[model samples]
Target: MTESAPTPQPDGLDVYVITYDEEGHEERLLPSEVTDAVVERSRDFGINKGSWTIDRIKHGPLIAAESQLRLVNVGSLARAIAGNYYGTALIVDQTPPPIDEDVYDIDRRYDVDVVDDVLVAVVTQRHPAQPAETEAEIAARLARIAAAYGCRIVGVSFALPGGGTPEEMLSHWPEGEEWSERFRAETIETLAGMAHDVKVSIATDDNVTMATLMDGAAAMADYLSATQTGPLDAAGVLNLLRGGHFNLLIGEAESGYLEVKTQMHPISAPGDTGKKAKVELAQDVARFANGDVDAVLVIGYKEAPGGANTIGSLTPVADSILNTAQIHELLDARIVPPVDGLIIEKFVVTATDSVLAIYVPKQPSEMQPYLVHGAIAEGKVEGAFFSIVRRRGEGSITTSAQQIHAYIVAGKRYLRGND
Candidate 1:
């Protein structure tokens, strides 16, 4: 067979040379274009008149311009390329900007130039009349932006108008300089409430550049994707609660395996003296068990008018509105084919605010299609026999006859050693 022409390969470094004009417009170039530009620029600068060649380095591509000067700094050459050609190069791995670094010096000019790996959102205080944006608003905006790029917010930092360097701000906060203690405390509180285990920092114009934020957000998205373990176990969920990542948990929207409720069902237990609460709890558990994945029910998170659920006041849990053990006992009594690894825990968020989380793990194939027996008011099936309830996006619904049949067939296959 005749040999085919060797296919051209892309530049191994995967670097982009971006050149900006005096008008602040940008032009991106490939590795070859960058090499030609550097050679021509070096000749123009009178630093190197000899021939030049491109050398491939493990880190990235390098322009080796032959020069008579004995002491030539490569860093200086790189800087010249950027300044003279009005172009800068970026490597995917290196040159990524560091978060929480000072961007400007005392003169308020660009000092260090680097690419960023995270999303640095700069919340500037414009006109005082503008409504004060809440943490929720910021988070919602971030969610929309991140979703467009298939990423998530990993960190958030703030920049106040006339806020000095990060170091100055830190020292000033302690001394109560310029701004009052209450103002400083409120700023920190607001940031802490939104950070959700992500790193939050005070940054100057020198460090909190748009480039840095974008790079930081990218790095964060990678980290989250790698470390994520969906549907945490009871212990893992508890760790998130105590570790101040509760905001992160609540930030997530309802999905197949997650559900949020304003309060426990039946609202009242002793005074009402009915099985409504028990039945409702059982239905919830049964619905989760019938689904393909585990589920987490977050109580005390009420849905607002705009479909945003916030951590509402937990007077019920605080006032002993519902007992955890009792709820578990009731679920056991009502749900047939007992749910294994069902965990119900109460966490005291504040003195008067508390919340309950119930984790229902997916049962084995042999125990599929868990059913509810008693009449559950507002449930998918009321006064029905052997009702298999399945959870949809955010609500529970009665499983269709086709779905029930598929579940039975799968269970039979497992029993027959076919699955």
Candidate 2:
């Protein structure tokens, strides 16, 4: 538990991501040699970038960002800040979109669970080449879904960068006034209902073709940065609005490029291929335990068959860890077992003084029923007897000598008592 994540701050913020995208798990679960290597490399990058994120958060008022853009100008600025301030920064992204596509799909995605407690909601609005939905309608839908879940709906907003014509804005934005104003109003309304201080912002670099859009973003960013705590960055600026330090850059850029490449070290086990898998699985178990989750019920391990003397492909243990890591960065305490078909009825888990505790008592009210079996453990049964009143093969009643002696002693005692 001590090694796991620290206690979450109640005052910070709960972020919720809504989208209709689904995470692709096929490559995540099992990868070929090339894909595995890619994963290994990405893991290294994720760790390094994650460290920066932690540092910036711990230090305060620094940007931590990631982007799909090859040359992240905003990331460079954060790096400059860290370089001068003796601080750290986190800038990581799997691709151009720092927010997972599935995480974006509020309609049919589960990644929303990650930000279930978020104090703010940030999204990216792509001014559609053609209009389909209205801003007010979108807001209504968002409110409905959030209220139905009993989750406090703080704000629903998007991060925009500068540059566009008024006609373009009208044609692009659902509301005719301006995208920034419309978004800010909606955000304020949502937050006011939730009884929380809230603000939304947009960002954009000065550009001619997209000047109007950029102006709108800059205006909103300025307002929020002044009145609220949000700031602007090279990325889409959503991360900053989502409570991330406004340092790293997000989104992909065309033409100009600055891609950072790094190598990854493979975790190898000589004559033992299951080591990585085991570590991953254990980490997952540890995280569950840390979160005070009870038992982990595993459907049997999925595996490819092997010959009488060969090892199988894709270790289940490793898969478990990878899956767990995707959900959480750390694990505290959890119960894990290798077997399948495990069930616990209304189990409770608690942690105290760095130790995770689980309690199960053999009370009848809580006991589960079991079918009698032919094989039973010795010493579990108090006694056993068999008798045949009449047998065609001339069988007779049978009892152990010990039982017979006890019966005789009881009969003698009755006789002596003149019963």
Q: What TM-score goes with each of the models?
A: 0.42, 0.18
The lDDT for every candidate, in the order shown, is 0.48, 0.25
Can you write out model 1's per-residue Cα lDDT over 307-336, one digit (the tens) per residue? 554332223346366578777877887888
Leading candidate by TM-score: 1
Candidate 2 lDDT by residue in tens digits, 1-419: 36987754222111111111135332211111222123221111121222222112223322222322122222222222222223232222333333443332221101011122121223233332222334444455334223322222344333223332223333443555665677656654443333221222222221111222222333333323432222222122322223321111112111111111111112233432333333333332322222211223121122224322211221122221223232222111112222122222111111211111111111131111111111112423111321111111111122346764786687799799996
Q: How close to the true structure is residue 221 of candidate 1, measured as C-alpha lDDT?
A: 38
- Model 1: weakest 10-residue lDDT segment is 104-113
* Candidate 2, lDDT over the whole model: 0.25
Give lDDT: candidate 1, residue 375.
58
Please estimate how well model 1 matches the true structure, expressed as its whole-model Cα lDDT. 0.48
Best by lDDT: 1
List candidate 1 segments past 4 Å from native.
Answer: 1-238, 267-273, 308-316, 376-384, 401-419
lDDT of 1 at 287: 82
C-alpha displacement of 163 in model 1, angstroms?
Answer: 29
